[model samples]
Target: MKIAAEDVTPVAFTVILFLAWEGACRLFHIDAFILPAPSAVFAAAAHYWWPLLKNSFVTLWTTVVGFILAVVFGITLGLVVGWSRAIYRGLYPVMIGFNSIPKVAVVPILIMWFGIGEIPAILTAFLISFFPIVVNVATGLATTEPELEDVLRALGASKLDIMRKVGIPRTAPYLFGALKVAITLAFVGAVVSETIGANAGVGHLMVQAGSNFQMPLVFAGLLALAVEGILMYALFALLERRMAGWAFRASMSAAG
Candidate 1:
């Protein structure tokens, strides 16, 4: 099959970015400790491949597990909240207040409770990601047209039936959108907790590298996190296109 120009753009853009970065580092005679060139970063990644691989896996595992929990709980709670405007409004402030507390503060509490293991990282990821999913799903359902509901009601559809048949389906685009955002946040959450307390994970690796003055390795750890985040986001984006392609079609039709 032939490759699309669209598919090539991102790769080209990334290459250009890396080249610019490398050129700037050379032009400025930047110290590796201050900012490693992409070449040095790649060398570190290659040299510490095994450690990077193991730590990256640990981070991925915790992040994915926490993200899964967020998806299940968030979807259920979002559905319940969106079922009625009263509950949505009532719970909105509570959720906002909870989400407002920086995850960094909560990490220490989690470390105390979970004792510096993967559990804290997992929970931290869950806590960080949960709100966006809930808000987006709830918004998707709550924004359902009142006229549409009235017509369905007049046709003898029960509220539950209407929600099951229409509301949930319509919420797909929003849920998928939230999934993309939440997954990235979940990674950030995992890395943050790992940096604070965990024995394993890219965050911990970076911390070690920084203390040892291995700036290239530290940058390599960051590169690993960026790569993982991009992959997860792309997965959700693909799922969105596959599952909610109709939403796009509808929007385009309206626009035209």
Candidate 2:
């Protein structure tokens, strides 16, 4: 079963809000320039469909790249730290300090280093979004049952064999949990970075729309971004359901 509330909730809420918004705009005789009705926003989006999709793809690509990097680096570093006491002790403090710093504050430096393009946006997304994944994965890997470890060792399993047979498999759920969080942060980070210094993306389009007082266009851009985020989230949820079927079933059975 889907972990999410049924899609009907958001769909119904959106339909009702749009109807209310349009009615309010008509009743108040609001000018389209101020707060355009949902209809007007849809019309604008329909008219600009191609450019909107193009810009969306640009942002989507950056987000995807950043997310992949975060997962790879986060999982790698997490495994290294979790499996080695020395590295864990040595790097834990530095990781905490770096994570404490506001990632957005480093955007200027990122741009200075990588220039105002996809690279900077992607790097910013990776930098800000990777810490949680790493921390959670490390914790999960390290906190496995000590009794299990002892049993596996008595059975003559080597360190590598134990890690392969037990550690990573057990940590999959935690890694995916972090993926859920990382995906959203990755989206936000990419869009925010693009907004700060991008010439071509949905964020850039929204900035342009705001500058020209196109509130409907701004709303439309935001709506598109929201849709993209929802789609990404749903994709992850679907993958999780499929990949964790046994675990999810076990969870459900236990809960019941």
Best by TM-score: 1
lDDT tens per residue, model 2, 1-256:
6656686788889899899999999999999988899999998899888878988899899988999999899999999888977999999999999988887788788888888989878887898889988888788878879899999999999988888888888787777778888888888888888888887778888888889998888888988988888898888878877776666777778652
What's the TM for model 1? 0.98
Candidate 2, poorest ten consecutive residues by summed lDDT: 247-256
Please give the lDDT score at residue 91 for candidate 1. 98
RMSD of each: 1.1, 3.0
Instruction: Provide the lDDT at 77 for model 1.
Output: 92
lDDT by candidate, in order shown: 0.96, 0.86
How well does each candidate superpose onto the true structure, as a TM-score?
Answer: 0.98, 0.89
Residue 22 of model 2 has an lDDT of 98
